[model samples]
Target: MVVGSMISQIELVLNELPESEKKVAEYILANAKEVMHMTIHDLATKAEASSAAVVRFCRSLGIDGFPALKIRLSAEVENTPHVGYFDVESNETVHSIIDKMLSNTILTFQNTASQLDAQSIEQAVSLLQQAEVIYVYGIGASFIIAEDAAQKWLRLGKNVYAISDRHLLAAAMATKSENAVFWGISYSGETREVIQLIKRAKEQGIKTISLTRPGNNKLSQLADVSLFTSRAPEAQLRSAATSSRFAQLFVLDIVFSAYASAQHDFTVEQLAKTRKMIEILYD
Candidate 1:
């Protein structure tokens, strides 16, 4: 059986493999289930190659070696049926609607995994931590994500501003320098106002970061550090701000958590102080 999405990856580089390595790749793709239990020597022998050739094959796929390749295979099998948008049928029952919505959200998160890269996430966190101020700009539903982001960073004592108005965001961008950061949120990565704000930040020599769906778009292309969320395709019912919104939030939560973790002591103290102040208001 074709093991999982790895098959597609293997196929993509199939033609590029040397003749002997091609044998091993073909063997793995054809016997994916059986190969999961096989050692490198076992695979190499079966494919009429040596253990070293198997290692070479694994590296070609960007995997560390045979063991790591097998682990990836297992995960692919489990994570198959990759998330795709599913439209809600007209006149659907309330129960079905609930299930559909929950399923869609779950799929959105799953899809985001493929869009994210470790290097970009780490770089974004480091930039966020180093910056003295952060300006977040978005419009419509994306602005809600910007608000959520500002609130999260604020708890950690980061100076995060979520500005929905175009003029205000541009003004804030104008006053900032490279010491500040501009974080733009646009699912399509083409939100005009958001784009202009990030552009302005860049003009002021501010570092710019962006969150958008996975694809080439103006805003992401404009920012210094471009980040991507899941690509939720258009569907009749899901054509709204459903999957993209969740993906953006997921990315923001990850970045915020990473930032907070990096400065654990300070973040904890800030959280405690904020909590106490809020509690006093309620009391």
Candidate 2:
């Protein structure tokens, strides 16, 4: 089976594990590709559990042993392309910036595309298309992307709610149902408030989506559909966030445009009406 199939299977079996084994199960589910590259000791260390626990965790998944599990995981990783990371220097020239930015953007697209599951994107778009209410939450730089998503969906005639206030957003999530979609955008995927809101949405049975950097993080683990941006490591000046943010928003635009194209006539009419309204206002 393919890596995506393995991941789907793991997700299906995740809730069946005992509470003690669940932690390791969660870690494996979130970090399946990365786990293949890690040693048994390294995997145990990262999961903050012992080797015995890790073995038991694998057994719970119906794998014969760690080596067999690792072999299957390695196959999954081999099928996926690797992402590259570059560091930017402080005194970089304009030409250097252009070159680095282009490289970073290309790498970001490649990485994101490699990890993109067509079914998940389709599922997310379906949820967004049918959602009666959509709430987006993010903090700092991610907040900007959340706002972008809100704007795009709003223009497409969807009811979008994006607020910077954590408490207010959490309250909004409480009143929503499966017809509502809560999107959580975070780069590190460990942002406390975003994670908290997504958790609340999950408890409320609201559809949840996450956009974050490619890695194992709490936000992705809890999300119904997880979309990853490129993994750009931060420097002293924090150029990573700056470049990756644009890349992520670009992906969002692609998703929005694709969705609009899928409903071409309706979206076209909507766009024309919006333009006419704006033109009348300007006149």
Candidate 3:
């Protein structure tokens, strides 16, 4: 956990915990304010779980230990409670829909930003910059993020390819340059195609980057550099993509902006050239 709301992180990993660990998570979720004052032993006894289970739960959240978890909970408990995703109702008003969606997006961005690791982001940028060719892959909604990422780097004159077809991407990976990079976007961190391609990329000795939601995941575990977005709970009509996608895009903007900032003059020149080219198309 970088610096955002700790409670949200707990919720994000709640479902992933084991039966005994889930008990600890449930207790904390219900009594976050009180948990701030209770000792680890107290919490373990109250949650009906052991001290080891408590420690395991904390580790699952990327927290070092029970004391750290309490400190984080105390800090966030005083703030306004975390506003989770709300499903759009059949009878929802237009105004209500707008408000709910806006709130969700804002929270998603805040949480995602808080959890970001500056060093990890820096490493990812360096890899992208050193890469001679970049291949980005995602499936369905994630494909949109992959394409957007390709365009951002393309404007900087990078040879970036965002191929939606898994077969084609695999073919490209086979002949990828030694200095190539692969970026994978899967919110769940478990998309089969993305995983398969990342494995291929690694086999070819290409540096790999993964964009996924916060928490332990297969994709992040496999990537050389891991970036995370906020977890968006399921929504009936929206399927959580509305906020999750925005969160993914938000992370992308941060990475792209950081990359651009590192090469200020080059980025400015390239952006100017691309802008002029777009203007020419309009003319």
Every candidate's lDDT: 0.79, 0.75, 0.88
lDDT of 2 by residue, 15-91 (tens): 65566567777787788878877887887888887888888876654456788777866765667444334557878
Model 2 misplaced stretches (Cα beyond 4 Å): 1-85, 176-178
- Note the clash tally of each candidate: 0, 0, 0
Candidate 3 per-residue lDDT over residues 14-36, each given as its tens digit: 78789999999999999988899
lDDT, ranked from best to worst: 3, 1, 2
- Global lDDT for candidate 3? 0.88
Error of 1 at 227 (Å): 0.9
Report lDDT (Cα) of residue 96, candidate 3: 91
- Provide the TM-score for each candidate, comma-separated: 0.73, 0.68, 0.94
* Candidate scoring better on lDDT of 1 and 3: 3
Error of 3 at 25 (Å): 1.3
Worst 10 residues of 3 by lDDT: 1-10
The count of backbone overlaps in candidate 2 is 0
